[model samples]
Target chain A: MGGLQAGSVGAFKGRDVISILDFTRSDLEELFEAADWFRRRLLDGNVPKLLDGRLVALAFFEPSTRTRLSFEAAAKRLGGETIGFTSEEAISVAKGESFADTIRMLDAYADIIVVRHKYEGAALYAAEVAEKPVVNAGDGRQHHPTQAMIDLYTVKLLFGSPDGLVYAVLGDLRYSRAAISFLYGLTLYKPKRVYLVSPPQLRIREEVEMVLRERGLPYREASDITEVIEEVDVLYVVRIQRERFPDPMEYEKVRGSYRVTPELVKKGKPTLRILHPLPKVDEIDPRVDSMPQAAYFFQASLGVPLRMALLTMILGVYAG
Target chain B: MGPVPDSELLVRKIREGTVIDHIPAGRALAVLRILGITGREGFRVAVVMNVESRKLGRKDIVKVEGRLLKPHEVDVIALIAPTATINIVKDYKVVEKRRVKIPRLVEGVLKCKNPTCITRKKGEYIRSRFRLVSEKPVILQCVYCGTLLHEDEILAQVLGEQE
Candidate 1:
């Protein structure tokens, strides 16, 4: 594994990552502990030389700007090589091959498979078929488990468990699978309240609502950001839904509706933390990126260490 | 067509045939949607819908008489209704009885939802997939668009489009 080193690969030996919610509370705590180790190792310039000859396969059928590069970077920093197709055009998949066959073919070359397809459950299905660890990068509008992991890490680092602290998830809750999965995960920690802020059409999903309700987790809906600003501990935001708002007129109507500007964050208490899943058009104002409340930049940077920690643990290469 | 058979709706016993039993209530018609069985089938197909079953509140049974069903057709039987039990009736005797397993994906269970999807919008043939999210209520996916639709959703979309 040229993308990751052999020495630091601990606890994470041979695990399939189909969904973020699949992890038990213990499972995550273990990974976070490993991440702390990876972060420290990376900080000291003596990174773990685990996964020396192992290869990481990245088969992203859909578009991903940050996730694709970050995984490769994580692998390289750990002393492993990265390979695999970014899209269907590069493989026999476009020539009409079954996902089963494509995965079986890649299984021969890579120890771990990281896939981001447009179909929901694609990664889960792939994990069932492949004889290696499968990481779901993004599946349809259903899940982005890795992003949720990094988000949770950032959140944990910020308010120190902030369990019972309120989080206001604003913007496109409907098409934002990342937001949906993250909200599902938040239930595990027992937050005080979760304000599912969205436009009327972008209501929180029934499945997510059911999961939270079943767990006896308290959550409410608010269409306006003002309703959440005063009391929110964390402002979790998702990307704009350009795909859904096809009508330019309707887009114009909602263009500036829920933006989290630096001015807006400052208007709230100084302690309010703003986090985004990123690649934002206008949901979060750029000026807010520099605000004290802006934790997304730090959150984005943490993805490397968090994922490195997960990869290291899944591969199981404890230090000598 | 004719007011179902006196014995059943679409089938009669044959020298050698496959008996599909233990289907969920009102899904005998859905078995036809799988396309393994003929609409105007040459072989006699007996459909017993809404019949009482201890396991299922009410169930369906399709008995194909005379010619034995091919293995691929048997596989399709498993894909259509996981609850369906297949019995190899040879020489008018129940040689084997077993429950069917759900296939990972249905080749063409129904129509894809996305109107703009290349498979649905312009193509003469469209292949939709179902990932079996829930067993009681079957679910399939539009390969092009990531839509989690119930089996009834597929029937509504497909049958509605045909109408």
Candidate 2:
């Protein structure tokens, strides 16, 4: 309440959540405060049905667990209904239905759309086709705006704010849309430093790197996580996706190159928070889950309230 | 005139078409492409490449016989050849001449090389739109995907058909 505009109604009403870059530091700060408000409400067992009588279409052309379900849960928790498909076979897309036509169909039914697809610009395309706002759950290996929102919100909850936190983004920097989006989100705030930890072949994409350089964001590239492990306040890890690799041999080469273990966490600061966009494969050690430094489960839990805030704000129902 | 330059002699003067002068050397073919003159448009096109210029060390020139250049075509020419001057030929005389200026937004002229760009979708028919980000190296960002296209990529897209 002290941070953002006071009592401004529907600042983000019907706006498309296509890219993390679309929001400024101030916008995100306002959103975090809203998320905190929702968190408190949920904790008090007083859920506000801000999105009552609303419809959300979940158009997931690619396979997903967290993103799809979290958006669905977010809508329902706000007294909103969810529609749309999880796979192509569940819809007309399997029958050679065009992406535009399918989106148009959803637009007629839903008040808003949350899209996840294997193609990079699919969500942007959907936003173009639909009159309703489109939220990008994940798109190709480039963008996952809402996941970045939850990640940043978690960091804010744990460490006061994401500002001035030395972060080491570990694992797949090139092929993970969640990782890419998180990096983009960091540019909205002032970070002390960001250490990009990835294998040589999986370094951050050239365009993403260019954006960081343009923003004058201080960052360093390290092939191994241990290089900056001791210095970072946060170690954000992501799975090295085999499905993203165009070449099977290339995937084999980088497979298991980076893994977060209890031993690795020991190298970091005592107060270090480890985060991952879940449904991870072998990249993280299960034994490390019980460690005090592990914040991924808590991070995942924050997704619900964060998304609930997002839904209400997008629908112009966030009176706060 | 001080013994007409050999480059000028290469292509005879056109009676009722536009003459594009000072295209960057070796890019006359690309200029022709942006104009959609594929040598099959039934218009006689004379391309002169590696022509010596005092301003530009070397240049290419494209002369199309009987068609006036469109504004969009001029916009694209500015992208590849910023210093280019367009001369309108009418009744066997130069009627109008102007230097090309790069437009801020280019739409439906060049295909975005980003295969995943919304404009590149098979059945969407979304017109490719690009914003001019940098002028020196000629960088363009796809309005849909935010993918950057450097000079090489921009050239390749301009040369491809405008489908």
Candidate 3:
């Protein structure tokens, strides 16, 4: 956090939050500092009404519950309003309206747009169409900027910094946007090593691996989680995305391929923390949820303040 | 330049058209497709393939009669044939000749191979767009999805084969 003061938040004003790669290390540091400030203020029962008259449009072309609610909750806590549809079927898109038209409508209605879509570049397309700042809640198989922010903040909260930690991103590396964004976020810092664990069919994309190499980040790819289970400081898990598989048989073959259990947790260092962008399906055994290593719930809760930090900065309302 | 080989002389010189010489061997069809010169276009086209050259070992050359290429068409040619030299023939003399230079941005020539990319949506009316990210290896990144298209993908898409 060295020269990154609250005033550094000015750079983010009216900027689109579409990809983690767009952010620099100091930009992340500034955001994390703001999130930390919001976290403390919330605990003290002082909810700032900084965005008193602003409106946040949630244009989710795909279905989502946790992400939609957290954004709504975040905006409400900041005394802002939230609007827009959760699914394509719930809006004019069901009548065959174009994605750009949908985004244009949201832009007309709100100050900032939070869009989630099944297509990979839908958020980028929305940002292109809309006048308002666009935040990508998630995009197909690659970007989830705010989720990655909360995740890095969680790591910072636990280990005091995201740097110099050995991380293994387990499960659907190919199809999981959260996992891929987390990987992209890791490139912003210096990690000791990262183990990409997935079945060969679901291996990390060559393009992503190329970026990781370009960043000079140390990494290894493995088929099994146990290869680095004992050495990793953080095990970031994501569910196998069944819907993303073009063939049902391919989905069936990799389903339940990796699981975290209490016995499996016992093999790791006591300080090892486990994280998942949840609504998981049979990936993490319910028994492990009670363990000290289960930091996913705490990670999920931090979504509020992290998003609050983002909204305030993007809306240009952060006086500090 | 010593002498033109017998194979190179098979397609006689054009008096008033364009000669695209020194294309990477076996890429003449791709160059034709980039130029939209399907045999249906009815222009007198001579494709000489695998001609021996000191600089390129073996290369393909395309000589078109009664046709001049548009700038954008030449730009697309530069994508697949960086070593290609475009010579505007006038009265059987090479009036203008210049090696192809890759453009800073390319549009509608190559499709993003990413199946889930928004630009691939059926009714979106979005044209494919790519930025020239690297010239040596010929990398094109989709402006929408940020998916990279290397030389092979670019060639395939330019040849009208879907990935």
Candidate 4:
């Protein structure tokens, strides 16, 4: 209530969530506050029909689990109807329709569009073609703006602030869209430092590095996670995606190079929190789940309210 | 006198066309490719490479007779040769002389090298777009994929067909 006034929601109305860089610190704060309000409302059993009579078109051209379902749940919970395809096969895309045409078609039916595609910048392209607000759920290894919001929300809930936190992004930095999104989200905050922990081949991409340099943010790279695990406040882990690697042999070498086991978690700071953009493969050990540091499940659950906040705000329905 | 200086003899003066001067050593070919100049009849082109220059130790010059580049075409030249200058020659005189500056946004001139870039996907009408992020190294960030393309990558990935 103190953060997202009706005027704050106005800033998000009809905005396209293509890149986390598009949002400033104040904008993200408003979103986090809005998401918090929704979470509280859900807990109190007060389901606001903020998005009632609206329709959400989810165009997931690639495979998705949490992102697609969470958006659907968020829309439905707000009393809005959901439409669109979860895969290319479910839609006319299988018939070889252009992406622009598909987006234009979806724009006609839905008040807003959430797109997830395997190609980087697909959401930006869709936003160009669509008239309605376009929310990027995920776009290849480029960005996942909504996931960044959820991740930021989870971190904010745990730390009470986004300032001065030392974050260690562990694992495949080059290929993970979640990591890229998270890094972009961190730019909005005054993070002390971001340690890029990955193999030589999988170091953070130059585009992200350029953004960091432009912002004058401090960051360092290390081959091993243990070097920075104890010093960081949050450990954001990402899986080494096999499909992203063109060479199978290179993927084999770095596949399981870094794993978050109980022992690794013990090396982390007392307040260290582990978060992964779910459907994680072998990056995080199951034994570490019972620990207080495992915030991924809660993080995953936060997606509902986070996306709800995004959807309603973009649709200009959130009166808060 | 005896023979024009080697530098002066490199590229013949254009009566009425565009002269791209001070192109870094050997990038005239890239300029031609970007400008869609194929040296076909009716369009006379002279490309002089590795010519001595006081400012650029070595330079390349392209003189296209009877052709004036569009604004976007000049942008492509700016990307390829940041130090190059564009001169519009008309009636045997340099009518307009201006240095090429890389535009903030480049659209459809180059292709995003990332195979998974939306612009690269088939059946998608998304035009390849890029934002000029860094000028020192001449870095281009694909507006769609957020991938930073360097100079070498730009040359190789520029679309063959100019729209």
lDDT of each: 0.73, 0.86, 0.87, 0.85
Question: What is candidate 1's lDDT per residue for B16-35, written digit by digit as tens?
Answer: 78888887777676676564
- By DockQ, the candidates rank as 4, 3, 2, 1
Which of the numbered candidates is closest to the native, going by highest lDDT?
A: 3
Give per-residue lDDT, candidate 1, residue A57: 91
Candidate 2 local lDDT, A187-298, one digit each (tens): 9888999999999999988878888899888899988888789999999999988888888999999899988989989988999999999988899999999999999999
**Candidate 1: segments with Cα more than 4 A from true spot:** A1-11, A85-102, A243-253, B1-30, B39-43, B46-63, B66-154, B157-163
Q: What DockQ does every candidate get?
A: 0.13, 0.59, 0.64, 0.78
Off by over 4 Å in 2: A1-10, B1-17, B24-26, B38-59, B65-67, B78-83, B89-96, B156-163
TM-score (all chains, Cα) for each model:
0.75, 0.90, 0.88, 0.89
lDDT pick, better of 2 and 3: 3
Model 3 chain A scores worst on lDDT over the 10 consecutive residues at A1-10
10 residues in a row with least lDDT, candidate 1 chain A: A1-10
Give lDDT: candidate 1, residue A193: 90
Residue-level lDDT tens digits of model 4 in B1-163: 4857566675667799988889988788878877777777569888898888889999989888888876566867787688999989899899899999888898877877788888889877667888888788788888878888897677555533321
Model 2 steric clash pairs:
none
User: Model 2: how far is A171 from its true place, Å?
Assistant: 0.6
Q: Please give, for residues A1-320, the per-residue lDDT of candidate 1 as tens digits.
A: 21223454333567677666667666677777777788888889988768788788999887787898888878889998889878888888778887767877888888888998766556766776778788889876677888888888888889888587889999888778788878867866879898998888678655556556777768888989886688988999987566645476876666656778776787677788988878888777778877788888888888888878776666676442
lDDT, candidate 3, A1-320, per-residue tens: 01123554466888888889889989899998999889998999898898899999998888888899999988999999999887888887788889988888888999999999999888888887877889999988779999999999999999999999999999999888899899999999999999999988898887777778888778898888876799999999999998789899999898878899998899999999999998888999999999999999999999999999999998889765
Clashes of each: 40, 0, 0, 1
